[model samples]
Target: MKYLLNSNNNILNKLKTKNTLLAFDLDGTLSPLVDDPSNAYIPDTTKCLLAKINKFKKYKVAIITGRSIASTKKILGELPLTIIGNHGLESFYAKIEEKEKWKKRCLILSSNLKDIFDQNEFFIENKKYSVSVHFIKKNRSNSTIKKLANTIKPLLVKNEAIILGKNVVNILPSNKSNKGFALKQIMKKYNLHQALFVGDDNTDESIFEIKKKDIIKIKIGMSRNSSATFYLKNQKEINSLLKLLNDVQTQGINFLCMNMD
Candidate 1:
């Protein structure tokens, strides 16, 4: 409940223990944010680190984001870990296929809403399978956002869609979709005693606020008086962090085996 801000490597210390779950946001954290989100992919270093983590069955890796499950898989290419998508409205494990289908079907109405807005000439900007109406470029002014919200609110409500106001305005189906909810579900599913969340956007603050002592929050990119425990400047720093985690895991295992022998 109380907020804590920590340094860059504080969370890494927690991961020194075995059985840590590393959950990451897709865009702007694992992958750089681009004009188009769909094309975004994690850098080779990040991907390699993830594959290494997957080797230890005690540790679990999950990707939590606003993209659809199939879309997330499409971008990631090879899905070895669990994923929660459409914010937490959808969750898919490596073994389960039915839940993934159900979540996608539940979002079918969202596709219709997308078409409706497209017909109305509402400039859809953050279309990486996650649609957002960005008023940020039109001068980051509150009035611009307010005008767009006023125009779109009633239409979205009528269609059973909800507006998620972040750096931009996003209209999506009224599902309990958000990173906080998604993280909780993943934590429970994995029985995660200690975890770490790394993200770069305001939407990520939601999860950071709910974190327990073992679940530390990390912010990548601009630092602010946020719920994040630490901050990093760019993707390079994030890659470095992942590599550090991998090396720590490798060394710990070797130490344990030597002691046992």
Candidate 2:
């Protein structure tokens, strides 16, 4: 992936377009990854930049995350932006019955999976529509975690899907909905044609796969063979990127006004 710097004139030119959608992954993109997910919050500087962008008529901002809608809303605390949660299964404006159905299945799976591994070996997080088996806190060996995943993988039924990330395994309904689908839906709803998407993990890969010429895909940190076209050195760089976006939008608006004059 190419390093995204302010000197990249080509990218800066593309970002200046009106009707652009600015999408971000919440946990590792907008907020630093915390040991406890409940404590995550958007940095004040970044939040201010996002608020400014949201106020622009020609620009739209959104948060797309694997978090549940209610959880994301609670942390964000009232923002004029679209939120796509549960890896795209839940949204700010729509209620999905499938989420409730998946919650039941996840509970059952969590109970059965717990039987195979020692209860203290890992922690289970039930996110209503999805379940996450977290091995991070336990400090289990990599091989041990792999073995546990292998044992649980076979137990998944046809309608269930599993994705591995960092030291966690997430089980969710195997539906057509994902970050890519959610991004497309949001763009379509707003009649937007250009988008800048920033994310940090494998879950964000789906959004990177969207084959749109105007889509700017930015990965938060380094990864092997990431599909994103650009990379930010780390989460700390997210603030810099947001500031640049804010500057670009301000420039765009000033240019429009100058043209009118």
Candidate 3:
């Protein structure tokens, strides 16, 4: 993948004005990656830039996250950005029937998982619309993944999906509930001409794998396996990117005075 900061010219040339969706993943993209998800919060510097970017009328700013809507809402209080939660299973516009369906599924999975895995082995997060099975000990993550994958298979519904994140396992519905599917829905809903999405893990690969030219997929941490074409080196660079984007979106992209190394 190419370094997004270095390719200022290409990045500037590709970005458009109105009907452009500027989206981000929450943890490890907008917020620092912490051992505990609850501790993850948007840095004041990054939050300010995001708030400004959201105010730009031409672009649609959104948070497409694996985070549950309720939890994300609590963290992003009064942000006023479009939020696609539970990897798209829970949203502001989702049908009531759909929400109830996932809620039921989560409860069952939570109960079933609790029977087999210990609190130390798996820190289960039942988000109503989804379930995340996390490892309590960082050193045991790789081994824990093998155990998690095997243990969850029989307990899961045929259509349910199991996705691995940064040392975490996410269980949710597979029926058009991935971030790619969510992004497509938003693209259609908003009639967006193009999009710029930034994410940091396998969970975000769904958006990166979208075979479309209009959507610019940027990975927060560079990986050769990642389908994203551009990326920031790490989460620390997120604020810089957001600041640059805010400058572009608010004042319009300037080729001459804006290129940063």
**Which ranges in model 1 have alpha carbons more than 4 Å from their true place?**
1-10, 92-131, 134-147, 158-167, 252-261
Per-candidate total of colliding backbone pairs: 1, 0, 0
* Candidate 2 residue-wise lDDT, 1-261, digit = tens: 877753533475567755888899998888888876778898777778778778877678999888887888887876867888877777643455666677788789878777876657677777777777877473456576667668778888886776666567777766566788899988998999999999988788999988887899999886776899988888888877776677676763222111100
Worst 10 residues of 3 by lDDT: 252-261
Task: Pick the lDDT winner.
Answer: 3
Task: Evaluate candidate 3 by giving its C-alpha RMSD to the native, one decimal.
Answer: 2.4
Per-candidate local distance difference test: 0.63, 0.77, 0.82
Ranking by lDDT: 3, 2, 1
**Candidate 2: where are CA atoms >4 Å away?**
92-95, 138-147, 252-261
lDDT of 3 at 127: 87
What's the distance in Å from true for residue 121, model 3?
2.5
lDDT of 3 by residue, 1-261 (tens): 988777344574455455689888999898888888888788777778788877777779999999988899888878898999999988756789978888988988888888888987679999889999888766455566767777788877788888887778889955557898888888889989799899998889999999998888999888998999988888888876776777675565554233322
Candidate 1 lDDT: 0.63
Ranking by TM-score: 3, 2, 1
Better of 1 and 3 by TM-score: 3
Q: Which candidate leads in TM-score? A: 3
